[model samples]
Target: MDAHPDPSAPAKPSPDPLAVIRSRGYLRILLLAGLIGVPVSIAAYGFLALVDWLQEYLFTELPGVLGFADVPLWWPFPLLALSGLLVGLCIQRLPGTSGHPPSEGFKAGGFPQPRELPGVVLAALATLALGAVLGPEAPLIALGGGLGALAIRLIKKDSPPSAVAVVASAGSFAAVSTLLGSPLLGAFLLMEASGLAGAMLGVGLLPGLLASGIGSLVFVGLDSWTGLGTFSLALPDLPSFSTPTAAMFLWALGIGFACPLLAWGIRALARIVRPYVHAHRLLVTPVLGLAIAGLAVLFAQVTGENTGEVLFSGQSALPSLINDGASWPLGAVGLLILCKALAYGLSLSAFRGGPVFPAMFVGAALGIAASHLPGMALVPAVGVGIGAMCVSMLRLPLTSVLLATVLLSSDAYAVMPLVIVAVVVAHVITGRLPEPPGRRLSGALPSASPSTV
Candidate 1:
């Protein structure tokens, strides 16, 4: 008889895509994920607290001790110059070159080696506390990954490289969950950056979700216990928003079109500054810091708002920009955008922190100013601008949308359609834009290139 007779028999089923994950070892990984979260969350919290304390002491308390009621317009000049020197020393002398360059933007590099953690922490602390226009996310990611790898090596020396990577990613998920105010959002950000997909996505996400959930709880408990409030992103008391109209859609398109150009400009400026930074870091970095300080002074003198609005990563100042948009004149808002954008570019080229928050702040300022147009409302304008800018800068549309909308509380759902449109348009346009020219110099600073350990 022909073998074709076997067709009558039951067909063999295809194996489940997740069969490998369903194996016995996965449960162990899951348990380890939960355990890793506890210490990672605590470490993340400590890092944020230390940065906060340092910022206050260096910028505020020190000024008071010197007999000034508040930081003077000239204060940041010297302060930032000193910060640059210290940061430069850390990067040049320390291993891991004090983590990756901000110019490369946010990337999900795998776990850092054990020895690299100190450099990452010290560099980030210096940059953030000294008022660099950068965020804390990048350093936290590096720290979490480093710690995770170290833990794995100590506990299971023979663990496969793949297992180490999974645990490291889980550790990162825990580290950032609290900062973003949502474990889900943090997971999405990391997942997108890592390019995880399909069966692998599900497999990877399970442990990460476990770690992030526990981490968020740890953040809550710590916040409650210490009364210091969580370092998570929050925007309280947002103004109500109306349903998006044709006029708002039109404005969204305009913002979508404009933001890519802004992103390109920032990238180009950073590329241009990189060579100079590499050639004369100690000099160029300090000069860039002074330039940032000068911009702050100019913004303050012109807008009469506190210079603090223009300095640092712009995380704490974002709420004021949104809530106080109506009170700020169009001219003042415009000046703030100009100053912050320039400062942001300078910081990216020379500093050692993430680029997310400063970009958001600049975009928020742009949106608030655009609200002055007849059709645009404050809430929609703010949401659209942020989404568009973030997508352009970070190239992660989902994370950008969540970040822009979630801050609006209940208004998030209402404006989400508009935010989506803006983000899509910006992301597409950004992709079509030409890449920045390659650096002429070879074998430059370790952080200058995008490669991660």
Candidate 2:
């Protein structure tokens, strides 16, 4: 009886310790990807630096030389609209290159084919120079990712899916590293965007993070060696902090509540313009471009400020918006926010660029508006506004905080608490925002699919 095995107690099978990963082919692909990523990251970093120079010296300076009352409000509008058209055409016409960063959202891995890089570069530079509501950082990631994937394909006859993802991540890390002003932000962006889980997190994340670290180093080295300067959304003269006050915390709380409203406004405008952009694709796009130009003219005329206030890049204007204006009336501040927010929403929908800078501009404007209220300091208010807006737009809490801190030179410590409070408030407020009507799932309507990449 004892020798007879019970029917329910048969011999147990041994577990293969390596069974989890050994069966999957992704590990080999990941290794190959890391091997190819190092140089690609370096190249991407170098390219961004060059583009940075062009944005400042070429785009900013060109109009001054042309001299149409400082190139007039209409100048960049047409050039940028044409750029959006080209980018749209490129996305529609090019196989494996059908989308850019803005359309793609925050998905982790991306690599555009080499053929698409030229279009990506031209569109991004043109869009930026033309004063589109978009940001350059988004395009930079696409360019980097696409070029990196292209490199992998060339070097290897066939690459594993894992390797492709790793390279793309590395390329992205490099491309936007300088814009973040810290490789850590780049890494955080990737990590938060990836949606990776469990063991898969370690598979290629390390290599991708390594690439970003090296890329930032390369960016710093080149900036030092060439004295070309590292490109950042920062003003060198941003005054240092005194100690943060309780009022600054209140500013964060207020910014937190206000951020959702701004976010909704931006998205709503984008939705409104998207159909128009799509319907008129080739013909109507240019008209929309002219409209933006008209709006710019109106913005300058109504506000009685330089057309530059409402025009291209807006990077230079960020610090000014944050810096308190004793002469700026409350009415002017409100008008600035409304105009910039509207322009930002329209520009985001029809134009090609990133959302980061526009968000900063919005926040800065909001800060200016709030500063007019009693008991608010300019720097802390600006920091709260920027951080809150970023949280709403990107939904990246850590990234928003870093962005806030990096901008303040002396008062970073004081600003830190406010940034945290603002980010948390912004994040919570963002959740309260209702998803767009078209975004809801229903059998009767079009599918709103969720994507991992």
Candidate 3:
């Protein structure tokens, strides 16, 4: 036997996942991520634009054109039914089951395959544009990741899986970089969802960070060029709040305790409804839409508020709800919470969008209602409520805390302590709660990724 190893032999790959950070191939991936961010961001912007236009034309313009003084109480019934029909078709007939079900809660597991993008997009459009109570994040993530992986495959069909995954993640990072109003917030969300930490986390996140930075520029540029606002989350002109009181901490604990129970009930209803919806999607989906519409209509009738308050993802309406918090009656706010939660649960069971905004809306509503309490100022109460509810629903304590504070930028420093306390309490409570019986459907895609690569 030859004592010397052959120079011609291929070397074994290093077991250390972080080794990729030092390789020339990783540099190539970084470059590709940068390049991909442009197209991915543009695509994401276009998708949001289309969703916005469709929503306006169908819900607002079309209603006016049809001679309605305002959108009639029954307006959403047929529109949502149509949405359900389209979404059902996409989920049943197309690939990828119309992306992950919102009922499964937020996650960052696998990206949709390129072939699955059409179904995901169509389903999300139908769900969101037609007034489903879900947001746009999940579909955006799927689109970005799918496009990224597809681009890489087209360039080098034989690319290794690790490289493909990294590029795909970068694509997702770009897609949602501006959706949450900050690239860092989006990064934090994906990072927590990604289950990466320490050295591996750095290696996994750098390409995505680069891509997200570029994506934000593209998003801003597109908004300027097209005169279409970036669909980023923002809550401007919030009432000033500084100094956390002793009473506020007690309020935080109470709100935190309450939020988990509310979240649990919402999720429990969705999970129970999901199996039945999947079993009879064609029939059940449209019915769920009608039910959601009924909830919105009922809320409108009771509160004399616009049905929009309870109909969609609540991203747009949230600011108005908070900015004009004093104008809303306590009874109306409470009713809004009840109706929106039902609509949200129904949407989660059968729709194809995101869970974040609706959850936030509910949290905001809860906070607004709680603001009526003595010794609880509106701003701190809202901050605590939002953080608690978000953590309860998302199980992402850090992201939930940041999300609450980021929206209240001026008051973030004062609110941070309360937000943290609420989030921690909610997260702990949520952890202790047992999973609902048969929470996951058969053949459901797992939501957590074991490896970032």
State the lDDT of candidate 2 residue by residue for 161-241, as single tens digits. 556667777777766666666777767776776665565666556656666666667667777787866665565566556
Give the C-alpha lDDT of model 3: 0.88
Worst 10 residues of 2 by lDDT: 444-453
Look at candidate 1 and tell me the lDDT of residue 246: 95
lDDT of 3 at 350: 93
| Clash list (residue pairs), candidate 2 | 111-145, 111-146, 112-146, 131-312, 135-354, 240-410, 241-410, 241-411
What residue runs in model 1 are displaced by over 4 Å at the alpha carbon?
A: 1-17, 437-443, 447-453
Which residue pairs in candidate 1 collide? none
- Write the number of the candidate with greater lDDT, choosing between 1 and 3: 3
TM-score per candidate, chains pooled = 0.94, 0.81, 0.94
How does candidate 2 fare on TM-score? 0.81
Name the lDDT of candidate 1: 0.85
Work out how many backbone clashes candidate 1 has. Answer: 0
lDDT (C-alpha, whole model) for all candidates: 0.85, 0.66, 0.88
Question: In the order shown, what is each candidate's alpha-carbon RMSD?
Answer: 4.9, 6.1, 4.8
Residues 1-453 of candidate 3 have per-residue lDDT tens digits of: 999999999998545756777788988999999999999999999999999999889988998898988777799999999998999998888865778777878878457776678888999999999999999988888888889989999999999998899999999999999988899999899889768786577888998999999999998998889899988989888888879889889888999999999999899889899988888898999999999999988988887788899988998898998888657888888889999998998899999998988988899889998888777888888888888988998899999999999888899999999999999999999999998655587465433222211
